[model samples]
Target: MSSSSHLIIKNGTVITSSHQKKTDILIVDDKIAKIGNFTSDDDDAGIIDASGLLIFPGGVDAHTHMELPVMGIHSSDTFATGTKAALYGGTTTIIDFANQSRMESLNQTLDKWFLKAEGHVYTDYALHLSVTVVNHQTIAELEGIIKHRGVSSFKTFMAYKTMMITDDEIATLMRETSKYGGLVTVHAEDGELIESIIENNISQKNIAPQFHPINRPIVAESNAISRLVNISERENLPIYVVHLSSAEGLNCALNKSNAKIILETCPQYLLLDDSKYLHTDPLEVNKFVMSPPIRPLQNHQHLWKGIADGHIKVVATDHCPFTLEQKKLGLNDFTKVPNGIPGVEHRLEILFSEGYLKGQITLNQLVQVWSTNPARIFGLHPRKGDIVVGADADLVLFDPNIKHTISSKTHHMNVDYSAYEGLDVVGKCQGVMLRGKVAIDCDGVLKINEGYGHYIHRGACVV
Candidate 1:
């Protein structure tokens, strides 16, 4: 077959969320031109021999906070560094939060995020408007963000009381989102419940980092999720639970009406446990300080079951980076430590090596949970997830035979330590192409020059 039309990925096994088939992919300009046995007729065509390899939809991480401003400090990685890290890991899209502060205007927050991300992303991305105050203007602005900006998801918190909307305010936000054909993404850990526990713990001289998980128990997350689910069911609005960590929390989500609630879990919940924080020096506790803090190991198995059963719709990095110097700010107290971990560059490789190759999930399931499902949920489905005709040729040629151990020294995120340091994975991104241009090649080339990544204006619901 003559391979001269544009770009041809020949003889690869293409895996979509719904189907697995062997085919050749052809690309014209930026979009996928064809997907089948094809022979093109353009002289400048580029050919990628993909025989004996697996080609799945590029991943869409629905939750990430690149260069996000928070808590008197900014996240460690800028948009350029963070998105570049994601591309190297096989993710082609992200949906970051446009967080509204209590004192800041909603428009200002959104505009700030836009400016920070402009000229710095290597992949397509979108935003979810986080409503901090539930006033008329805030509610009014929600429509503008959704209608004009194509942002169809809104986030409100049950936790972070000072930074979150009140229960009545949350209800108002939920109602507004439903009215405008948007989904509500909830961070469901009750602030009041957590506050009472923290006060008691501090009174008892139990102010160490080890006491954090004890203060924010499984019941805290479970009860909050139950309440959110009930509210969602009553409103008949679809709710997405972000960063779910507890088995009890998972049960709360699972027991809800299937059509009303969708759970999103992170790798930290699946891999880390509270045991990591049981240290007297307190510095050791910094590694385990993420929100909805890591739970028991048994919950890990439950999350795998949830992923396999389709109760969990997506897995995201929540990729918030903080360096050791910043983490040290909480040396004497765990409550002050920033809550996040950097994992964008490791999400795909770890899942492929641990979940799929280890027999925990099938190839089809991996494609869905990691790639296609997230795109559909976040309104970037066919364009960002599938390797089909009319889709962008944002592709990754992953080589599963290679083995490597992860460490901060080799990883891309701007952090001092890897949360997943020393973990071995069997696969790596052998090659990555952004719209038919080689962004990273097998010899560990990270070809990131400024202006290579264009800011993409996303669209509304396609799920």
Candidate 2:
């Protein structure tokens, strides 16, 4: 019932990216001390009989936005609540964005985010500096940010008017950051084309939620991806594409270029479709109103194939949630709605039930994409992703036979609605441990305090 300085997890099937084995894990303090069967000499060591369960490395969600300000209001979840929800869902670490304002420096942005998360989180977290403006000062700060500030990735938006930088600026940032061992990530979507479409739709009085996807068509996404691929080839830099939605966009990303393009997709794009936009109730339709809206049902096959064939590297939820009352701000006008949905707590279960149980991907592949790849890509490798000796003892004890339906009533995210409301899923996190401490017990009860999480200083990207 209480955390011990020494702990042993026995008789569980340990699932790794390469193999699965029935092993016993010994934890001393905050790290894995041993991985083979052994008896403890310490009399006070806590022991857990994990028979018939699967022990996995805790999830590393590489993309999330907690307390993000967009439109006219901030997101529903703060660091305190969002990280707790993530812990309950089996994710132990999340890489959140610290967006830079046009006038503020990168350090200033990071400081603000630190003030928000330092003593208020329940799971370990890191920050990715988002670049809204590319200037001489920004370029000069890259070295200090990467070398001293512990941030190794820079996120750039190719869509939003306030966040989008020019093609030249993106190239310059790639060139500048690569010098300091930093990776450049992008939110790929053609802004000008989408803006024009939105203007036309508004003039025609087609401002409903259905028109949201129409305004940002498939071509817009594919075109932006193509341009980014071309730039990556020309600049000879690796680029990460966030939330690839349509098959056309996937094809563009697969264009025969020498550049390495890492792809990440969310659960909504793989499981849900655009049909939700046509719901009879306008309030219900607004719930699916995220940017690069869900694609048609047919595109799901292509994305799953991408995962199976090893084209996509990671699967992360771009978790940004807004309450229904806030969604009403754009009830009649789709452009005014906050663009996000909550799925931080359902990623692992949905992936296991839909992808692994259905034979779309193996359990190793699920663990690879959901945990290992994200940690390696975001520079939190052996310490946060694997179950090897000397690694941090962040783990999940899962019951593979448990079947349950996901609903907003039982979820933990601060938002009121669930993106995957009625979907049935297999595999549940019965218990979770963070740094050898009992954070979630077998009964799914939270057992940690706020401020239990520490800020992780990451290294260079390995993938």
Candidate 3:
């Protein structure tokens, strides 16, 4: 489909982080030109009747890994497939991670990610540099990465042996990145404890998929979060904790640290429990083998309360997917299984159904965590999130009453299995507008093509 210069969406309830109003939106080229009740005399303007639909700012998923190499295999979704699925789910912008290998410099890592994403993604994308090693030269690159490269956040892992760094290294990173207004985001799980437990589990013949969660207990998550919280407090540096899974971990993150601690949780933690590991079929259980694995059922309420109480800041899918064939690599040993699940396509719908429909959070808060909060935190605000005039016209026309069952057969992700299969969800994305163009029409037809997405050069964290 060709891009139209003028498009008007009429009679939709526009929902933002602040308010919701029945309004009309006018788009000229790539910006929202006007909003309110209005009529246009331009006959060439495309008109979309959005009666009874809820218009939302397209979601900004702050954490996603498309085509990432992990555990000797790459994630199933490429930039093109993953972002296309994201757009179908009303997420128009994703801040994916560009992981640095221990051997390569940070610049080389960024260049490699650019090669993977540029002209390949279907939605606007930004990147967070994942720091695997910290040296004098690595520390020196912080200023350029933050100030010049437009990457405002650096990702650190406290878990995986290859990706994890020492506490001293993390402190140095926090101190150095903060000097240039760059925020440090972390996967907070105790690597030493996890490794020790894995050794013990393997020695005792507890190598099944069910033992995956047993190997990395809740204490590991809580302990790491507590350590990071203490460091942030002592150093007066802000930190973002990604994919928080347990109640104990949430408590640690909320432990009154003087530094800013932004919390994030995923739908799996909110809805699914570790009981999934107990399924008789090993293949079925393998689908739940993500790191900082799904926690006990009791943790769900605590996570929901955190979101409702305004403690949790973002809801992002750590969308690294491995096919079942790849999962079989660990059929006998759980540690060989690639960690992560396909979730980019269902984040918005699942959040809307379970969060807003269940009254766990308000619509505004849903919009906040799902779209506005991530954009603001990742420095894509005003341009990526919100429905205000002059903002990029990335919008979703949602039918809140539309109910559907989630299954791998219908999902647009490249993976073979769905982490949320068979779950009934409300609020489907009926139409999507990206940069003043109708990317997904009211009938759910994809009007846009691959390579239409642009790279977003982000700024420092705003919240």
Candidate 4:
């Protein structure tokens, strides 16, 4: 058989958001042409015998920041490195935040991000505007971006008072987003509580990275989550809580009426703990200095429960990365360090080995929480997630039998360390295709083509 136009993935267990069936899938020109015992009539076909593998919609990471400028430093991964890491981990699409600095125009910022990602991205991408300074001008521009620029989501932060919005700003932005039919993504954390604690910690001469976990404790997170939920509910606005890390925050999400709120947590929040910060060398703790910091081991258990029961609708890699040098900029002052971890390359394996295979969550649940729900919530559903006909053929042929330990040596993100370093993960991505092009195989990122990823135009929030 000549191997050219069509590709057949034979005898794999095809898993979708809600169902898993043993089947073969035929791909033609980048769409799932046929499924369920599919056969190709064409002779020019390349086939992959996927008998023992698990096939899933490539992951859609809703919250990531690549080459993002933060606190006098840039994120470690450029759009190219970050998205390439995402492909290795089975994620085919990422909705990165288009950060609007307090002094910059949203238009300028969006354009800057587009230029940064133009020919570098290895996977499909979309933007969610982060409203750092919410005002009339910013508010008025939200709908225009949604209608014309294909940006359908907005993010507001409640924690970094100097760089974020106030309650009044949140209300205004949420109301405006509702008008534009866009989703509001909030970085929920009580600014007052956390700031006060940090001030006290600094005053007490406790200036260490480990103190960061103690300073911005779970109460701060819980307090913010509850307040955001209450405010959005009273205004009849729908909101999404990003990087939910504590039981209290999880409760605020789970206790709320489903019509009003959505919650998402990241792998760092689910796998690592405050213990990672207790190293004898204080600098070592800096690796875990993400905002809404990692919580107690019990919170990990709580988050798993949230995922299993469907209280949390999305699992994403908050892939904001910084090199060790950048991370050490605050060697003596923990507050000066950037807040994020690199997890794009380990999202699927950690979830599968720990969540699904352990029976904490089903395989379908894994597909939904990691890939399908994120795509739907972020307005990239039909095109980015799912194995349906006419959708982009961004697929992952995942081998459940592969045993690997995640580390900086084997990982692909442009970071000096892996938070999941040395941890054994059972399942790994064996092959990845982004929009019908082989971006990653056993060899790694292929230069089959440059600029293969298409910039996705997303739909306005259905809510």
Candidate 5:
């Protein structure tokens, strides 16, 4: 069969956000054409024997940063490497953040990022504008930015005074975006409080990464989230909270009266903890430094509970990578180190082995938070998330019994190390198909070419 011919996936337990059943899926050209009990007799068809495995629509990670320039250094992973990592791990679509610097134009920023990704991507990609200064002109660009540019979601940061928006800015941006069929995403954290706490800790001669989590406590996150929720509820606009870290933050989201609010947490928050910050060799702790730093172990139960009960709607990697050398920029000072980790490649395996295999979450819930809901929330649904007819043929054949250890040596992300190194995980993705073609084989190798990915023009957020 030709590489682009119709393919039949036989006898697989197809899983969706809320249902699962043994079935065969037929892929024609670039979309799923049918799903039923059918045997292919034509020689021009490619067949995938998916017995004893679960078939899930490839993950649509709505949150990721590729080749971002921050802290005087660029993220270690470029679009090529990052998307390749995502594909190997069963993620076929990623919605990355396009930064609008303080004095930069929204259109220019979008254009610049588009150039960077033009010929370097390997899987489908989209963008969400990161709004730094939300003034009248910035607000004025909403129609062109969302409707014309096809980027319907905007992200507002609350932890960097130079970049973070105020309550007024948040309110104004939220009001305007919602009015125009757009959604707002917030990096919730009280920058003033965190700055003061960090300053106080430094004054006490506490210069350790462990102090990183101490200064930015759970309340810092909860306070910001609660305030945003209050504003969203009052202004009648929906908000998405990114990288929710602690129990308090989860509660603030869960207790919200606004059903439109969506909470996104990362794999690091679910699998790791503050204990890594307390390592004896203080220099080693730089690897784990991230905003709203990993919370205490006690917070894990609450996060898992939230994930299972549907309070949290998505699980993304945040997928920002900085090499150890880049991290050492803050060796003399913890505050100087870059704050983010790499988890793009391990999201599926980690969630499947830890969350599902351990009984912390269900298989259907796994499909929901990791793929369907993310696609729905980010406007990539109906095409990227489900296995139904007419949807893009982005799919993964997962072997629930394949056991392995995660390590940087075998991973595709361009970063220097793996945050999940030495971790044992079951349930690996054995085969990945993209647009009617085999993209990744059972040997965990790429079968597609670089620049094979198409730029997706996503619609506005709907639920």
Candidate 6:
């Protein structure tokens, strides 16, 4: 009935955000028209034969930092390159952070990020503003940011002495966000504890990349997480714990002692451990210098168990990439290392290979954590994370049989190295669609639809 093209996918297992079933899907233009059975009688319909593939809603990475500036260096990937890699890796939508400092206005910051993304993105995108300073003026801007600017969630840092806001300020922000129905997502780490440790390490001349994780120990993360969780619990608001990296933090999120809070862990924490910091080569150690840095090998089991038991809600890449040259800024001082790694492109594959295929999580849990939960928590659901009728035709036909080695040599991220280098993973996105258009196929090629993505405004947090 519309002018857009139609397509049909046959003989595939359709995995929705909620469940997985063997079903056929019919697409009309950018929306899924019908799902279940498709006779495929229309000669003009584009048909994809997915005889041995798993269909799922394309991944939604809710935390990424594209073209963001931090510590005097901009993250290597821009919207253009980041989204391209995200698409090739089967993510059709990314929610990148729009950061603002106390010196800047929120409205102006949103405008600046919008200008940076407009006509340069390859897949749909949303934004969550990181509020560096919370005050009367900044709190007043929340209405405009949430309603006019279409950003329904805000992030606050609990670490980074120069950037951290007071607990009172965060409490006020959380209260205001609750009033406006927006979610408060946080990077939780005790700033005072980490700073003191860093000072001690510096005084002792223990200034190597390996010392990076020691300064910010598990307690730093757990103490901060407990504080924020308490605030969220008292305010009766849902707070998202971003890049949760330790057993203590995980326990705080699970609220085994008190209240429950939403949790997100990166693949790096799930798969890698702190031993990488002790690498013989300090430069190699610098590769994993992300905040809430990878934890002890023992914590990996706790995180996996949390995910398995449904205590951890989402898995996001907090993807902020920096090149070796940029990372070397801290060669003499471990504190100077830009704290991030390249991960947007490998999040799904690694999670699939290590989680679902490895029998650690069920298929439904995979869909929930990687796609549905992110959308649901950030308000992008029903549009970005489901394979149901009337939803955008953003989907992936994954070949569970395909095996590939992850390495910097073959990855598309605009970085010199891969944090997941040499990791072997089964299952690949053999085919993909964005809003009903064939974006990538079995050949793993993008159809050159540059700037095809549009800015999507998400609603308030549902969970």
Over the stretch 218-327, how does candidate 5's per-residue lDDT look in tens digits? 89999998888888778877889999989988888767676456899988989899989878765578899889799888888889889999989999889999888888
lDDT of 4 by residue, 1-463 (tens): 5444688889988999988998998887778778889577777777888889899999999999998888777899988888888888888888999988878888888999999998878888898988888777887788789889989898988888667778877878778877767888889888888888888999998887778888888888888888887887788888898989988888866567733778888988888888888887756888888998888888888899999888888998898887788888878888788888889888899999988888889999999888989888877878878989888888898999888888999888899888888998798887888777677875564544546666898987653
Candidate 3 lDDT, 11-103, residue by residue in tens:
999999989999999999999999999999888888999999999999999999999998778999999999999999999999999999999
Query: Which residue ranges in model 4 land beyond 4 Å of their true spot?
Result: 1-4, 442-447
- Model 1 gets an lDDT of 0.80
Query: How many pairs of residues collide in model 1?
Result: 2
Score every model by TM-score: 0.95, 0.98, 0.98, 0.96, 0.97, 0.97
lDDT of 2: 0.91
- 199-271 per-residue lDDT for model 1 (tens digits): 8888888777778788888998989888877777777667788998888898887786543778898888878
> What TM-score does candidate 5 reach?
0.97
> In terms of lDDT, which candidate is stronger, 1 or 6?
6
Considering every candidate listed, which one attains the maximal lDDT? 3
Q: Which tens-of-lDDT digit does each residue in 168-217 have in candidate 2?
A: 89899988988878899999999999989888988999988768888888
lDDT (Cα atoms) of all candidates against the true structure: 0.80, 0.91, 0.91, 0.84, 0.88, 0.87
Evaluate residue 76 in candidate 1 and report its C-alpha lDDT on the 0 to 100 scale. 94
Off by over 4 Å in 2: 1-4
Candidate 3 lDDT (Cα, 0 to 1): 0.91
- Supply candidate 4's per-residue lDDT for 109: 84
Model 5, residue pairs in steric clash: none
- Assess the local accuracy of residue 431 in candidate 2 as a C-alpha lDDT between 0 and 100: 98
lDDT score for residue 297 of model 5: 89
* TM-score, candidate number 6: 0.97
Q: Model 6, poorest ten-residue lDDT window?
A: 251-260
Clashing pairs in 3: none
- What TM-score quantifies how close candidate 4 is to the native fold? 0.96
